[model samples]
Target chain A: MITVDATGLSCPEPVMLAKKAAKDNPADEIQVLVDNATARDNIVRMSRGVSRTASVQESGGVYTITLARP
Target chain B: MESVTKERVILIVCGIAFAVVAIALAAMGNPKNMAICIACFIRDTAGSMQLHTAAPVQYFRPEIVGIILGALLMALGTKEFKASAGSSPFTRFVLGFCVMVGCLVFLGCPLRMVLRMSAGDLNAWVALIGFAAGIFTGVMFLKGGFSLGKAAPTRTMTEGFVFPVVALVLFILSLVTTLFVASAEGPGSMHAPVIVSLIGGLVFGALAQRARLCFAGGLRDTFLIRDASGLITVGILFVGMLIYNLVTGGFNVGFAEQPIAHSEALWNILGMYVVGFGATLMGGCPLRQLVLAGQGSGDSAISIIGLLVGAAFAHNFGLASSAAGTTPNGQIACIACIIVLFAIALLNLRKQSA
Candidate 1:
């Protein structure tokens, strides 16, 4: 599992960071942390582009989204 | 399916309404060649502030303010207000700036391009072609995996209301500040009254939001994915505007002496080429960007900032052309913008080993 910290980042950055991290570790489960809904939605959309299933869990204004190869 | 159908209807209705009001405005002395041009108006507004002292193109436009306030009211009513910012704020700003530079060179936004052509300004033909080519280039980048990252959702009330608030402030300032001067003549002087223009803007904003109308997106979808929903809206707008111009005796086919336009064919096309490509890459047209900002898209707000600064630069340095012809510095600015844009594209590309 590879964890990418994207807390406090805005829209495209979280998705861009997650995408880059995923590209670097093809088979690893990538966990992204985001702070906002739009970023989460965008990451979900980007994950679909790469054939990854993304699941989200939110706690205390922090969102943890895990994406893995499907 | 029902929702999608309703969306399409909204889009078409908005397009037609925009055409009707735009044509009516033209007849009312707004300008024959340009009924609604956000970029041109901004440039003119910049001049009004004596930002560049470009005479004959200085006027305070109420339509811009109307676009924001109208959209704000609709969003508030519809419960779609949300404000948030993320993504590379500076990068979006640069893209906005480039978009303005390119649009000014072409002398209109994508919306105005169609209106100009439909009015028989032959120069618009070149612009349209160039715009398509630009969109094609952006499509290439998309195919190659160009992305601007994502936007995280935020507090619906707080995030969404920020831009509208700013717009409201600007509208209020527009009324009180004699600092922002209006043009005595030229395209800037040609305007409909505040009430009519504001209502027109409100109608446009409501319909556009409901329909997802975007000029560059319309062309991009057509070329890349063979999608026609957006493109159809453009078609309706052109046809509607054409008929209205004819009925009102506003049609003067041939391009010369066209309001807010120039006859430089090559530049007209290439300018929009840059604009179309840049706007597509950014994921929306200028008007769409404005609407997005009103709806609390932080990235879009950054883009708007870029647009205003770019307008300042265009007029200050003489990059923007006028009714007379293309300025000498205009060509230089266009070439420079293209070179810089390509550089950004190259840098943003993912490197691959051969």
Candidate 2:
């Protein structure tokens, strides 16, 4: 599992980090943490391009998105 | 200190500084309620270069120069500059141009919108409502996977030096004074002292760079994430401005006779609606764009070019509004920009195919 913590980073930063995670761990499940919805949504969209399905869990404004290869 | 606390403190400091700088610039002579307006200053700078022949609004503004240079220097000192580009260059340019049209229609960018509203301009209030509505709409687009794509990192640093170099040239020209055209009368002619304005811009630019303070993104995050971090800073700035205005007897709440503003409710609303939408599409406000350009983003530099050209275009084509009211040409341009914005938004959307 590749876990990417994107809390506190703004848009495009989080998205870029998520992209890097996917690139480096091509066949692994990626778990991403973000503090906002926009970054979460952007990461989820990026996951789709990599053929990964994303499941999100939220608590206290923090979102954990797990992207798994289908 | 915790990271969160540190970030919040930086934001608060930046906000307070902005309030102080805006007021101080005005006191030192940058037209009343006109301090720190990115669009207006760019327009004036364009006029000074004879990019447009507007007689009353021609002046080489040093604040613009100071801002870009300040951001560039801070980013460099902190080793945060990473020059890159290639994310929908033309689309970003159009969005930049369209946003400037919207700003001219309303006579202010987001920063000046706050300034005008704090000083009791009802037109700005109307524009605020439209800005919020537009942000909400941009949120809908985001939900549907709207993005400008990723910018690839460049190998060389030369691309990132563009805006900084421009700022340096402008700084020297501003000090030389006679090198550029100066406005004889009107809003363009009114200005604070060159050194004072540059200092204000430098302070504002450095703080804003550190905090990533953005007026439009604050609104965008408000609608998109239910996060108010960005808005909190703007709120702080507002309260600061409000307090200063009230204490100094500058506050006069009314629908008429506000300085540098018009009362056409619909255009004011639509104008900012376009601004909010375009800023969202491009990511960041006009001020943010300048900072990003200084940070070595060539894409943002292209956008800034569009802003300067758009400012010239608005004045040359009579598509900018005045204190009297919205011009017929300006009204048409606003509507056209809105249509073009919708088109860009729809065209750039990437649909996922499984």
Candidate 3:
């Protein structure tokens, strides 16, 4: 599992970070931590582009997005 | 399915409102092909404050005040009002400043660019290409992990309320023409009534806040991740304008004799390129910045200040293009801002996770 803590980052940044991680480790499941709904939705949307399934968990205001290869 | 339908409905209503308001305001004398330009209005606002002594564009615009206040009202009503601020302050200021410079070089913001196209200004179509190129470049940077960090929550609500309060003051001052300097001619002098501007701005602000509309966001999302959903509003807006113009006999074809626009293709392209590039880095366009400020973003408020000062600086330094054509100074500034923006983008890229 590869973890990217993007809790303080915004959209396109978090989306891009998670995407780069997935690209670098194609066999690994990538998890991205974010802080807002916009970032969460955007990251999920970006994941869809790469044919990855995104599952999200919410704790307080932080979102942990797990992107798994199909 | 119900929620998705609701979202689409909201987007449609917002798009229709923008088109109708834009045309109505134009008819009411808000300048041809420029019913609601945040960049232009704010530049004129700066001139009204004597930020720059540009005589032709000097006037305090009430629409700006309405937009800010209207956004504030909706935000507060929705319980989303925040003291959300403290991002990369200076960087955003510079970016905002650069965005204004870019917009002026092209003679309009994304909204006015669409409006200009609707009015059959071919220059706007050329500018659209440049804006896309710039957005494409920014998307490449995003794919490489480009970011300006994040905004921290403000310590006090007072910081957030400042923008709205100041806007209220400006709006009040706008009613008394003697208190503020206004142009007797030029675009500044041509305006809808003070009440019309305020009410129009308020409606626009509330709708924009609700819709979360950002022209740059639409283009950026489309370029970056192939998400075209953000573009529903823009598509609707353009179609509405085209239909309205055709029916009302407002359509005038060709680049020459276009109102408040120039025919210099290269500069028009380069200018909007700067706007698209800078706004993408900043996460929104000039209009979005104003709405963000009204929603209590100190960072956006600073960006607004940057826009105000930048607009003034453009006029003072002759970096602004006019209907006559792109001036030499405007040309130099366009090239310079592009170089500066690229350097900023390169310096801010982070490849590491977290």
lDDT of each: 0.76, 0.83, 0.86
Q: B121-180, model 3: which lDDT tens digit per residue?
A: 999999999999988888888767678877776677888899899888776766755667
State which candidate has the highest lDDT.
3
Winner on DockQ between 1 and 3 is 3
Over B237-321, each residue of candidate 2 has an lDDT whose tens digit, in order, gives 8889889899999999988999989999999999999999998888888998988888788888888888899999999999999
lDDT of 1 by residue, B182-291 (tens): 77877778888867777777777766665566888777766654455677678888999888778777678886887678888889987998898788767778887887
Candidate 3 deviant stretches above 4 angstroms: A1-4, A18-33, A40-70
Per-residue alpha-carbon lDDT of candidate 2 for residues A1-70, written as tens digits (9 for 90 to 100): 9888877444855765677788788889999988644466567656666778888988754789998989
Q: Which stretches of candidate 2 lie over 4 Å from their true place?
A: A2-70
Q: Tell me the TM-score of candidate 3's A chain.
A: 0.95
Give TM-scores for every candidate, taking all chains together and pairing residue i with residue i: 0.81, 0.86, 0.91
What's the fnat for candidate 1, on a 0 to 1 scale?
0.00
Q: Mark the regions of model 1 whose C-alpha exceeds 4 Å error after superposition.
A: A1-70, B1-4, B154-159, B350-354
Candidate 3 chain B has its poorest 10 consecutive residues by lDDT at B1-10
Rank order (by DockQ, best first): 3, 1, 2
